[model samples]
Target: MSIVKIVEQALKDGYLTSAMEAEVGRICNAASELSIEEYMALDRLMGALLTGEVVVLPRKQFINVMEELVLAEAIAKVAEIEATSEQNLDVGDIAAYALNRLPPLYATTEEGANFQRARAKEELQEFISKQVKEAIAQSLNKPEFFPERQALGTSSKEEVISQVSNLLQAYAPEFEPQNDQGTSSS
Candidate 1:
């Protein structure tokens, strides 16, 4: 079954919420080689993520189910950092260290670094927001799933304004890329 289908079933099974299903859908689209066959693990993992349930899967199966294509160790580290952060470490420190030791996705940009504190939880929010936006954008590709009301969800002026504000806060890129390092196109 497709990840979406699996997620929907899992949601019905009391594993996850509709909102979380929507979020995972984005992550699924972001990945490279992940296929529909292994979504059961994702449904389980996401439930774990949202509820702070510790999950241990067979090594290969864990990697196959994760959305970012994160390796077993990396997933372990994100989980570890998240766990340790409350007592002795911050996510930036962990992520910075991770950047050096791990691959690009965890390290790519420090866009989420400063917000990694337990109280603020910025990095997690950033990750979720990005996934949400990406999922919504990609859903547009399927007319059946991305019906007009569902796709935009902006039938009123106030809703539109709120949506735009929320999107800008969460998903809007910071700069349009420097044309010549000193100058901007805008």
Candidate 2:
């Protein structure tokens, strides 16, 4: 909810675009809000509903929400930097609040640091990385994956227009952009 508030305000105050706000909201909606412990437990939970623990399947929605959460942090970091002065930056407060509320990563060091890097944290990171990599691998096969394949490096107007024209021909054959004549047709 705080993320939603931040994005909405950012757009209203002209600091963020409406499209960017919507994008953040969309990603946030897909994420699951679990403390570190809860998330770890889900991996070991059995029968899709582990005993005494809530086993959450990665739902279609969580992905979007997770994306939003990621974007919100990035946007917040940017805002913190542009805050005009130290008095305007609420970044530290927000970060501290989130970290404080997060479940204490199971076995911590005697010094109270979660830096037992040899522990569950590594496994968790690996699991998450695998999940993301798999998602991208699947997306690569999608027909719309590279809709503007040649748009990656076009610098001049002619080159960019040519790339757009190719994409339009493949994706929107029914409609013709007025710039069709402007192309060299080579």
Candidate 3:
């Protein structure tokens, strides 16, 4: 949807969802220059946001406690290994590998998170350690097939903007800029 449509929806709903925010950011980044209408819509959105008429929802409302457990295990092991030898393991890779193999423990509240953490410690501590060890071993042995490959879910705003711009250009081949007269320019 266009920026104007998204703004209208947010106004009607009294909330700006993360997806809507991302979409607006994508559209704004994709366009070479904002039209008057688009600018006006953005202004309205800004005003509404400032006035608390449209609330912006957080990107994530829950946490996966398992990720924390795995990361802690991985970091400890990596630190120990790095301390002894010249080998510097990627803690992120180890944590990600272990996390993928383990079940997620999602919690929306602190109490729930503490409960899950305690449960995992009681039941899955050994398993979590084993997974982290296996992940470290695999990471050590795995060849750097794509050393240049960037990690997922870690894109900066500039990178996201560029990606959105590229996607728009690739997908919307027929899209044209609107001239000041409100007519599409060839």
Q: Which candidate tops lDDT?
A: 3
Number of the predicted model whose TM-score against the real structure is largest: 3
Candidate 3 lDDT, 1-186, residue by residue in tens: 999999999999999999999999999889899999999999999999999999998776677778767765776788799899898676667887899999999987767877887798789989999999999999989999987766565445456436435544543333353476956586
Report model 1's TM-score to 2 decimal places.
0.20
The regions of model 1 sitting more than 4 angstroms off are 2-151, 172-186
**How far is 118's C-alpha from truth in model 3 (Å)?**
0.9
The model with the greater lDDT, 2 or 3, is 3
Worst 10 residues of 3 by lDDT: 169-178
Model 1 C-alpha lDDT per residue in residues 1-186, reported as the tens digit of each score:
456565555555655555555666777787776755556567566775577553222222111111121122233444454476553222222233333332232222334422222222223434543443343334323445433442245565456446534543443334232364646688
The true-structure Cα RMSD of candidate 1 reads 20.4
Off by over 4 Å in 3: 11-15, 26-33, 43-60, 147-186
Candidate 3: clashing pairs of residues: none
User: Residue 28 of candidate 1: its Cα lDDT?
Assistant: 71
lDDT rank order: 3, 1, 2
Report the CA-based lDDT of candidate 2 relative to the real structure: 0.38
Residue clash pairs of candidate 1: none
The TM-score measured for candidate 3 stands at 0.67
